[model samples]
Target: MILKTFGWSFVITAVGLALAVLYDGWTAFGIVAILSILEISLSFDNAVVNAGILKKMNAFWQKIFLTIGVLIAVFGMRLVFPVVIVAISAKIGPIEAVNLALNEKEHYKELVTDAHASIAAFGGMFLLMIFLDFIFEDRDIQWLRWIERPLAKLGKVDMLSVAIALGVLLVSSMTFATHAHLHGGAHADKGETVLISGIAGLITYMIVGGLSGYFEDKLEEEEEAELEAEEAAKKSGKGGASAVLLAGKAAFFMFLYLEVLDASFSFDGVIGAFAITNDIVLMALGLGIGAMYVRSLTVYLVRQGTLDDYVYLEHGAHYAIGALAVILLVTIQYEINEVITGLVGVVLIAWSFWSSVRRNKRIAAEGGGDFSEKAEVSTGV
Candidate 1:
């Protein structure tokens, strides 16, 4: 399974590097290599989150995620998305944007960097909600009992996650807005820009998340009806509820969920890439390498049943995500070092992996089967 999952990723990396060398020689290749590593370091937590959602999807959809979805990740995002953003932001045509990217890379990079505040706000808020929901929900296992226990109780408040997020956004916007005016930088009204951008982020979260939850509820109702019918048939010794995931809005929403999630995660990588190199092609090739590996890792986690085996892994990933979200928000005004960003996530996930290993030993010693099965039952795996 590991080979089958990562084999193509290695091939993609080889091809990307070869193309990089041919296009702009070894200098470009080096930049691509750095960008790829940067992307991987920043987004390992994203893979874990993707795995948790991917396991719920049917095999066909999963294939789409790995194949069709990858094109979107590599080209649509790494290549085209930046062009679109630049074209719109600079009030130029797509042709002009492409020229800008190729002929005047520094100016193009500046435009992209200038857009960072809004990008950070949108991505940060979406991810913040994901973390908040996980932390606030009632769970069978509590990794950090003292903290999570209280947060779960606080979850009972209606729209608690959204409320808390808004409050945080409010505080951040005010503090930064005040700071921007006092600092007297290039942006004259950055405070207002930050505020509006943040509200846009909240609205986006509401629409996408609401649609996802609504369809999921409908899917659950249909499943319950099928289960009831299955129970009746079982009384007469017949087969059980259907396990197949058909093509429909529910599946479509799941796809949307993943795509948007990926786009949000891409914001930091895109902006950070400017810091490394201003060449768009090099940035794309490098980030593409990291993206392919992340997709492969997502499939690996799902097929290997890693989530089930490492019970606290998802918790750790989400916690890391929560931290990343806050860091992105903070970066709106300050220039944070990428090294610090990567290390925090690595530490949290490593800690969780260690905890899960210890947990498995305890469960085995107590004469229980793999805790993965129990985690599945609790998590609807």
Candidate 2:
């Protein structure tokens, strides 16, 4: 299963490095390798979140995610996205943006960096909404009971998640966003840009997440009906209906949400890659390899039922996302090291894994057959 999962990632890594070496020298190769590791480390939690969503999808959609989705991640976000940001921010044509990226790399980096306020506002708010929704929803399982339980009770309030997210955006705009740290040297009035971008992010989440949830509820209902029908048919000595799989609009919207989630995660990686290297081709190759591995890992976790085993893994990932969202918002006014961002996620996930292991041990000592199975049943997995 390991080879089946990561085989293509290995192939891509080898080819990407070889191309990098051929592109310039050992220097280019080193940069590409570093960028790849950077992307993977920063996105580890993202892979966990993605797996939770991907498991609901059927095999065909999963294939589409691994193939067509990788293209968008690599070319669309890693390469062209920076260029587009530069083009619009600098008021230059696409051809000019491309030329600036290739020939005038430093200037291009400055332009991209100048646009960081809007980028951070959008991505941060989108991720904040995800974290808010996760914590706000009442569930059978609670990893951090002290914190999560109260939040769940508050979740009963109508639009609590949206209200909190908007409040945070407002506070950020009034305080951090007004600071003159972004946009090449010192500048003000960034609050307006941040506010608008944050709202756009909120609206986007409402649209994509709303549609996905609506269809997912429908799919769940259909699956339940099919299960009931199957049980009845079996009692009468007849064939049962096959299990329902996620497809049609449900699958499409879910895929869209995943892509948007990826984009939000990639915002930091994209902006940070400029700190490592200015070559767009190398950035794409390296980030592309890391993205392929993330997709592979998502599939591995789903197929191997890792989440079912480590029940709190999703909780940890969401917590990491919440931390990242705050960090992104903070970074609008202050410089944050990428290492700090990566370590925060790793630490949270590690702690969650430890907690899960301890829980399993305690259950085993109590003579429970399998805590994982018990957890699955409790959560309706």
CA lDDT, every prediction? 0.83, 0.88
Clash counts per candidate, in order, are 1, 0
Q: Global CA lDDT of candidate 1, please? A: 0.83
What is the C-alpha lDDT profile of model 1 across 1-381, one tens digit per residue? 777889989999999999999999999889999999999988899899999988877788788898888999999889999998889767899999999999999888777776677677778888898899899997877677777878889999999999899988888777754443212245433666677877887787788877877777777787887889798897988876663453366777877788888888887888788888888899999999999999999999999999888888899999998998998888877777888988998889988888888787777887889586654222211
Give candidate 2 misplaced runs (Cα > 4 Å). 232-246, 375-381
lDDT (C-alpha) at residue 245 in model 1: 56
lDDT by residue for model 2 (24-138), tens: 9999999999999999999999999999999999998999998899889988999889899899878999999999999998888888887888899999999999999999988
Among all windows of ten consecutive residues in candidate 2, which has the lowest summed lDDT?
Answer: 372-381
Query: What TM-score, computed on C-alpha atoms, does each candidate reach?
Result: 0.91, 0.94
Compared to the true structure, candidate 1 yields what TM-score?
A: 0.91
Identify the candidate with maximal lDDT: 2
Candidate 1 off by > 4 Å: 178-188, 234-247, 373-381
